[model samples]
Target: MAFVQLLVTSLLILVTKADVAIDIENASSDVYWIGILANPGLPIPSNGGFVLNGGQTTTVSVPDNWVGRFWARTGCDSGTNTCQTGDCRNGVECAGNGGAPPVTLVEITIKGDGGQDFYDISLVDGFNVKASIQPIDGTGDCSTAECESDVNAACPEQLKDGDYACYSSCAKFNTDQYCCRNELNFHSLMIIISPRVPLKFQMITVV
Candidate 1:
């Protein structure tokens, strides 16, 4: 009986220190998933990540000093447990695995780098949905990071997702500039595409 009580007490303490909140919003009309990945050398709750319907908002707790990335998954088949984007190969929890690329990611580092929490939204893998992160009632540059503009609208029909998402240019074209690979077997292409690109025409050939 003493061991049981001690075990419960230890779990209670762990729950208390896990106070950081990851607030997620599904701004689109399709069902979305909240995917979590604990950085190597750090462990998140054994069971993490959940599902969310469109136009819904939810929060997940994070252990202090945790560092990880979050992303949204779409085109999932709950029956078959498959996803079109950001599939970690598990039904719900990522189990430490990361979402597939062409998915926007939000990364966070709590109590790190001079004892401060750092968070940012990223589009390096391209985007599917809009997402943001905010440190609720916290101090020290708790700025809001967000991506609202839908770049998929301008995606060429060849790469459109039937209104679901715009795939990364690499997924469709596999070019040196889009995939960030070297061309001609010995030349690196400079990455110059801005967060926003113009409608004016431009051309790129992979060969």
Candidate 2:
């Protein structure tokens, strides 16, 4: 499989108090279809999607209180507008649609409660590209959140999705323990498995 990496920067400017700037960069030699799914009633940036070629970068502006998830679609066929992984089944522009799993997700809630920003790189849906977020300029305990390891290289046989992605245990087995579907303490389980923390960022990268 070809190695793919994306670098994104979320630039929070002191002057632009009402908006945030997201700089998405494709650092690898591959074409990536960007997908953005914003909260209902909120405007979607770039009409919810765009394309980034290798070494190319694009900036998207959103409200300071924007809440959404961003992901990249790989191995996309322009003719059919579908991807081998992370396909939303709606072409390049997701338009509020989310990508299919085995996808690495960058979830964020800007200017959230108590005037804090929360962001995380999630693998609960599985893993396609190695991704990370780095906080540039922000208040409070700003730290990098990442899933930088090559999960696909070390994925167990049962969780392997060909050579492109790795399926999470829950996605592969659909069991209560893995999915926390029927668990009474689902929230607790989630915290143990995937913890969310406050983070401010200007850059995101996928490898």
Candidate 3:
């Protein structure tokens, strides 16, 4: 079976107006990977992108209002900035560019939706590795969000055979149910959607 290492994270966020720190921990036994961050309407993150060897930790700092998504590039050559899985610019920094589609993404929008921070593990782009986030300092019933299973193993026919990720069925099928979000078709669509992993979003309420 063809296997690929995808970027997946479960973070426990403690939201505040102060600068935020992100610590990336690599759990792989032998893969050399780098983390890529792409910010929208903000400057490139200081850590922007950095290499992490097996069992290494790299930390980055971002402003409170920063909104962006992060993903990992596996089997990458820091010297070349080329990744077998999530390559960005021809260098370490992402230069504010998003990763190629079908890549697993961990996205966050701080101070969104009634002044709450929003975070999610999205499979809409695709499914690769597992991901989740926990609030480190905060209060509320904000559930831990995650997607750890590899959906590619059972990827729908049209969306299968991707590099190592599985595309959203709606993205590939584009039917009335998947694309239009028709309530009438929801019941019938559930069966088709049931097998696929569900994306998760968490809203953190700061104390």
Candidate 4:
């Protein structure tokens, strides 16, 4: 019920000052796992934290005009069995396997575009997961005339009409509608999160 592997690499800096270097590998064998997202508050790492079997390298620094989108989320289980709840405490209700409904590792949404990104993951009964990208090239910036429109303030009873939820932990982002620009030029993304089964790799460097 748990098997994840992903790898994504991107860099497109077009200011044309002269500087282009892109290199990417690991075509496919299921990727293992990786993550490198520029915005959304930044600092996303704590599903289990740190996992990759072999062959991993990350170098991000896209400075010019800008365009980058990097993401990775593999497997989803740190092991050491950490998820306690005394018979579903707080409001006990022990049925068969103790009311099974807690496996972990199901929250992935990464659409591509640093120059047309592509990786649409899905899992919520509709099952459909396939992610693989292998093509690295660097330096090519200069497309910032600016044009933005990606707003969706959400709050139709916490939304579920179109389904794409993210914001619920005290809850406060209900349809005020003003947040989803997702375009802040200058590209750089490298992510890695591996779970050893038959894949491993990890290396991070940003300059």
User: RMSDs, each prediction?
Assistant: 10.3, 7.7, 7.2, 18.8
Cα lDDT tens digits, model 3, 1-207, are 011112364222233346766666666664534444645457566446666667675666677776777776665675666766556655666665656555667776666667777676666555555666555545455566567665656666677635566666554566666543566443433223234656332222211
- For model 2, residues 4-78, the per-residue Cα lDDT tens digits are 122432211111234676777777778888888888888898877888888777777878777888888888999
Clash counts for all predictions: 0, 8, 8, 29
TM-score of each: 0.67, 0.81, 0.72, 0.19
Candidate 1 lDDT, 1-207, residue by residue in tens: 000000000010111124654445565567766677877777655355678776666656666777877777888888988688778888877777777766767666667779776666665566676565555556566556565556566666766666766656666577766666555434443432343644221222210
| Deviation (Å) of 199 in candidate 1 | 12
By summed lDDT, which 10 consecutive residues of candidate 3 come out lowest?
A: 1-10
True-structure lDDT of candidate 4: 0.23
Top-lDDT candidate index: 2
Which of 1 and 2 is ahead in TM-score? 2
Q: Give candidate 3 regions above 4 Å deviation.
A: 1-17, 30-32, 78-80, 170-207
- Candidate 4 local Cα displacement, residue 83, angstroms: 22
Candidate with better lDDT, 2 vs 4: 2
Worst 10 residues of 4 by lDDT: 96-105
RMSD of 3: 7.2
For candidate 2, the per-residue lDDT at 125 reads 77
Model 3 residue 101 CA deviation (Å) reads 1.7
lDDT of each: 0.58, 0.69, 0.56, 0.23
